[model samples]
Target: MDMERRTLLGLAAGAGMALSVTGARAQTIADGGRAGPADPTEIIRLWPDGTPGGEGVTVTPIVPERSTDPAFHDRYAQYTTDPILTVFRPERPNGSAMLLIPGGGYRWAVLDKEGYDVARVFAASGTTCFVLRYRLPADGWAAGADAPLQDAQRAIRLIRSRAADYGVDPKKIGVLGASAGGHLAGLASARTDAAYAATDAADALSLRPDLTVLMYPVATMADPYVHAGSRTHLLGETPSPERIAAYSLERMDWRGAAPVFLLHALDDASVPVENSLQLLTTLKAAAVPTEVHLFQEGSHGFGIRLIQGRPAQVWPDLVRAWAARLDFPL
Candidate 1:
């Protein structure tokens, strides 16, 4: 079933024709009144009036396009001026929710491999999920590096404000991020201040996640183990020392933060295992309940991606168990 879905990118916007190139089953696209968590929903804008700092940003070409990289055949949503959430509901409500953040090195949002596919897996376990389509910093948002977190914080508040609508117990809400998205998740968890000014009542709800799950994330923006592409995209080509220090999330404050679950592959060439290790160390110092697993293989961006005989494929269950131990069961 997963294999079939991979080949089929929902709604071929370029051709403006059939939902898929091969007529495979398209993922459902319902909206607010949908009766159940198992069904997926259409996009919901985080800012109905207008996204702050994105007032003049050009937002055309919004439909998700297939990845051009031959080796990484998936879809990415770019030029996203209207940062929003795509819902993936559970077949049975577990009274919990997660704001799902995918990664494309902060250049775009990978919708399938890191999002829809993974969300369905958790939703099947009765956890309602919302996949975030955040604004990219390089796209000229005035907030610069803070744009993604703005979208993230807003998404979390949205979920909390509409908890009953989604059948979620607001207290059980958390975050799950991958690669660069993981960095944003970690930032969201540690932040004691709002990323953006209050736009509505939802802003009053806590933006810090009840829990955090980072999958081979871009942990440090500092020194040796930095994911250069992510750093450049978020902080520009030659960011100042202050900027570097600020975004190096592992070294940042984790006060009042939620417990975290870290997953990475020792052989992850793109985002080195040290990223997770550094975060683990800080989390321990901060006394935030933390769990970590460094698999010998399965490298980076393995978002529930089943590599035959590889241990990273078990990440979803690992996350499930960790959350359950914290009493925020998935």
Candidate 2:
């Protein structure tokens, strides 16, 4: 089954009709509730409110007319819905914060499996977790690569602007993405060659992240090993070879870039293991502090899910440990 949802973009006084599409199966009521780990510090629900009136913070659109495919809800519809982040403020109010980007191949967002679960883990420990419900490329192909990245930057900026209310350390804000989301997370972390332009009050805030967590991330746009879906999304059709190289992780400016934690599985087919390899190499070469972990046998997109006998899904724990090591105040 294919399901599509279209959202109207109201720019100034103009109405822009962008095909905001999603393809995924219908999500059951059970999909809304998470299984493990629950703590209620501060829960904030969001709506489509642009700027004037909304929740404590608003995730404004950086770009208008983003694509949302016809089958967006049918194929991977679960990711399309707006999510209420299960906020976890530290007992003593740690200043560090993280925005979790759940992966769905840019088609769906595994919000519960990756986004909420991971955020809960961090909030329980000592970090504020803001789960990012970013806009995906309408179609599975690279039709809407930049949309997600724009959303990511906007999310960081929003958090930073409201850091005081959220009890988060603006300087300690970090970003985490699973797969395609990981690619966007990396894009937000790295200094891309794409020209930085000011569009709105939101644009005035910096897009750079303080830290990044990439799980099975797509690192390069030019390399064959890099996920083609990711490449197509970032670089549209017939992109010059130079642009392709410029989009690669190795090509970006890593100086003063955020610290990164990368995780991937060796036996994954969706995205090759080499993607993480090249990224870690680039991070290290750039002297950006990073931590690399490669499991022996897990496959792709298995966020917070049990695979082997032990807890292969305990990635949140590792993240908690890593965040503590950063030594940033709450």
Off by over 4 Å in 2: 1-92, 138-144, 192-202, 233-239, 311-314
Worst 10 contiguous positions by lDDT, candidate 2: 1-10
CA error at residue 264 for candidate 1, angstroms: 0.1
lDDT of 2 by residue, 72-111 (tens): 1111223233433335565656778888887766655665
| Per-prediction CA RMSD (Å) | 7.0, 9.8
Per-residue lDDT of 128-237 in model 1, one digit per residue for the tens?
89998888998888898999999999999989999998899999999999999999999889987898999889999988889999989998998899999999999999
Clash pairs of candidate 1? 37-89, 37-90, 38-90
Badly placed stretches (over 4 Å) of model 1 are 1-39, 62-64, 67-73, 306-308
Question: What are the models' TM-scores?
Answer: 0.86, 0.71
Clashes of each: 3, 26
